[model samples]
Target: MMNNAKHYNLSLDKRLADELKSIGFIRAEQDLSMWCGKERSYFSSMRCRGYGLHIGSLTLMAARIADRMNTTADVRERARLRMALNIVNAVVQEKCRLREQELLTA
Candidate 1:
């Protein structure tokens, strides 16, 4: 079960990274951390702990990304941003579901 959870998190991380790269928003860890309104070590700590970002952070990040997408003039970049937004939204939904399940079990 632990291994499965770790694998799932790693997979999710890869998907998020790939989507961000596609949208050219992941030039550096500092840039991503700044966009998420977090310290530079935040992501590194999350990665080391094998967990994803907090739901609220993800939500804010998605909103910011969507705002950029809305103002983007390049068609290709807009499409890429849209795809990244979808990925972020999906992750946020999944995290919410997991949190709900935890609450119910508690």
Candidate 2:
């Protein structure tokens, strides 16, 4: 490959690919827990409640977001990033909701 100033370095690409792969692996595990094992929790037994979407649902949403976030250079990596971002957003939103519930109950 040509090393051009305009091109992203190979190391950066490798780093991103590895990160995306990790996210995919985790998401796949979540899918197994939720869809196959009848469990609603994942990743060291973290509950999936209040996150607005289960793993299956989030994966579907990710597929939709990936359509918009797609890039020519690395469509797959962008999709993984989109999916991970969506999961993070959901977790933050859910935490806020739980905090509000605690305040109201207190």
Candidate 3:
């Protein structure tokens, strides 16, 4: 049973690493877009399709990181859930204004 569960830890670590890399890429792209004085596409079809995905992945990464750092599974799980929620909250707060503006112009 212990060995069977070992994969979970490895899986989580892999996922966290991938998520962090993705977030870094997304942030860099966003920064470039901002520097060019243009709106970065928000989960657009033409390009930057992973913009929204980054937000979610970032949240998951936060949770997984917290879980890995925590001592107890219960505490880790709770922290992970809260971290995920906070990520979504942050993404919503960050994007709400742009979305509202788009809606207003439409």
Which candidate tops TM-score?
1
Q: Estimate, for each residue in 59-81, the C-alpha lDDT of model 3 and write its tens digit.
A: 44445544554645576555544
Q: Give the runs in model 2 whose Cα sits over 4 Å from its true position.
A: 1-22, 25-72
lDDT of 2 at 44: 22
TM-score of each: 0.76, 0.35, 0.32
* lDDT (tens digit, per residue) of candidate 2 on 1-106: 2333113222332332344357773444444334223454442243222122233443443454455466535767666557655654454355455446556766
Task: Please give the range of 10 consecutive residues that has the lowest summed lDDT in model 2.
Answer: 1-10
Instruction: Report the lDDT tens digits of candidate 1 across residue range 1-106.
Output: 5566556655666667666776786876556566677997777688888877777888888999899999999999888778878888998887787667666766
Model 3 TM-score, 2 decimals = 0.32
Extract clashing residue pairs from model 2: none
Could you say which candidate leads in lDDT? 1
Candidate structures ordered by TM-score, highest first: 1, 2, 3
**Between candidates 2 and 3, which one is better according to TM-score?**
2
Pairs with steric clashes in candidate 1: none
Question: What would the TM-score be for candidate 1 when compared with the true structure?
Answer: 0.76
